[model samples]
Target: MVKIKISSLSFNYDSIQALKNVSVEFREGEMVGIIGPNGAGKTTLLKCIAKLLKPHKGVIYLNGRELWSISNKELAKILAHSLFEVPKGFNLTVLDFLLTSRYPYSKGLWETEEDLAVVEEALTMVNAKHLVERKMEELSDGELQRIIMAKLIAHQAKILLVDEPTVHLDLKYQLEVLSILRRISKTKNILTVMTMHDLRLASIFSDKLVLLHEGKIIAIGKPQDVLTEENIAKTYGVKVKILKHPKAGLIVIPLSTL
Candidate 1:
């Protein structure tokens, strides 16, 4: 059930190393959160996985096939990437925007009934069915995030790579989006990987956390193991109070700097 296996992955921006010899594996139906401070290679890792960035060293295997070896058309059928910001100046309607995800499997210039059905289902999954007729330019940030997620769902990719999915959302929508992602991961058996700065939300929603520091993985495990006080202090230079919430389970409270 291992969906992605990255070994000794390394990437650089000219002389500056963005990701160093990092190795990780993600499995089906698992929602993984990648967390780190600025300049920690979190975004780099996601880009590598999405095949948007070619690593200078190391290899990435998606479902046992070398990621770089897969053609872009074929890769698009199995992998999807969502960015933190919505695209600008697009005049497409919400439904039309979502239908674009089907292009990998599409033929001619028309969408079949099946494609339309999948888009509708995806919209419902993100609780944005009411926004179907709305223009993408008119939707709020939170609403647009949901629509983007719906497009990913509609793509029906077995693996989803998202960067800072909750970045622009308010607290409520942040949780709502994560909840939708968690449900999609389970229901569709998609391997969901997201970069998040909100440690508490990551801890609560993720089945596993990958903590990166200075381009290397400091820890990878369940939230309790990866978000330890010692790890936080060392990786983030912060002192934190870890408390248990009666309803929400573990809560991370940043107390002060190291």
Candidate 2:
């Protein structure tokens, strides 16, 4: 299984410290959610893992190699990140847009049969086959999210880092997107790490949850263990009830401000 080990990772954006002495581990076939309030360094941690931001101290290892030792092209083949935004300036049809991500294997501007087949498979996996003909700019928020995911799938990366997958989406779309990520993580044996703001959804969908507050991990483990009422109150500054659901597993209910 693919393994990611982070140790004593610290980061600073000029004068403001974004992360501090953080550490965690992620394994393949598990969907881990990083949940926290604003300014909790959730995005910074992801950037550090993706090597988009250089940490000031400590190290991160993927498998056995240091994260910084991997070249950009090599990293792209193993790790891919998806942001909660649409592709700007593309304006192309969804099918054509997704084809742009296959440049790693195609190695040329021209499309090959392999590229076509892979893009088609990605479109099918993300359930966006019907939207292939639609323009990237014309899709709804939910549809755009699916297309973003399809681009990652087409990348054929083993590690997926997604930022705020459910932002700006309605309840139905939120559930749909998270379910898709969970399914693909287990079926494809990819290590999926996503940052989420919705505690209840994260608790239900994630196999593991890492709770961060002020750039440090408050708790990390199974959702039922890490998402306790005390941890929720400590990190979020809100009182909540840890409720057991017969169908949805554990759910969090916000009670009042502490």
Candidate 3:
């Protein structure tokens, strides 16, 4: 089902245009990676969808309803955004952090038994149940990411917008994080859209890819169709060789700058 439809979206920051006439459609059970150089408006597009930023022009529809028309509390139930940075010096336990996602639906300051059950389920879904008692400050980058995913699951949001999910991670963690995201997208039937800088990882895991350039969408489609050398060069000004991966099926290797 079409979970999101962005039509002619445009945004500006003071005198600077951040996103320009961009349009895209996302469906349930799909993971889409947004790729672009800095200033290409990838994050701006997500912020618009999350309603954190109002567009200068255009419309965003969530599950056939206008996004802006929905109340924040109602919208919170349908959409969630996972950020890149892990909070520093946070004293909350992993379970506590995940439980916060339920605040929108909470009746009071105390969490009911049902809320605890939801938190446990979300933790298990992200394979972070064992970390429930761990302090947020003690977890590694990867463990923190898993906790973030758990929070999203607890939110029970049908659509997820993640920005730079793999930032500051080693190769192994990057792979693990993307793999987890792909699984979550399918298993939970969530429409997951993330901004990523690693083109190779995006190609390997995303069901579809969106390439942005100069605040506009240069391409959007399946990985095979959108990750072409020509498109990469045009959007990133970098030359790359598209190679066949035995497992990944297709991999993009950067060759040189244009």
The 0-to-1 C-alpha lDDT of every candidate, in the order given, reads 0.91, 0.89, 0.87
> Per-residue CA lDDT of candidate 1, range 116-189, in tens?
99998998888899999998888998998899899889998999998898998999999899998998899889
Ten-residue region with minimum lDDT total, candidate 3: 83-92
Q: Supply candidate 3's per-residue lDDT for 104.
A: 85
Following a full C-alpha superposition, what root-mean-square deviation does model 3 have from the true structure? Answer: 1.8
For residues 129-244, write the lDDT of model 2, one tens digit per residue: 99989988889999999998888889888999999999999998898888888888888999999999988889888889999999999999998899888998999999998888
lDDT value for model 3: 0.87
Q: Rank the candidates by TM-score, best first.
A: 1, 2, 3
Task: Tell me the TM-score of each prediction against the true structure.
Answer: 0.95, 0.95, 0.93
Q: Which stretches of candidate 2 lie over 4 Å from their true place?
A: 84-90
Q: What is the C-alpha RMSD of each candidate to the true structure, in Å?
A: 1.5, 1.6, 1.8
Highest lDDT model number: 1
Error of 2 at 203 (Å): 1.2
Per-residue C-alpha lDDT of model 3 across residues 151-224, encoded as one tens digit per residue: 88788888899988898889887887787788878888989999998888888888899999989999989888
Checking candidate 2 for backbone clashes, the offending pairs are none
Better candidate by TM-score, 2 or 3: 2
Q: What is the lDDT of residue 28 in candidate 3?
A: 95
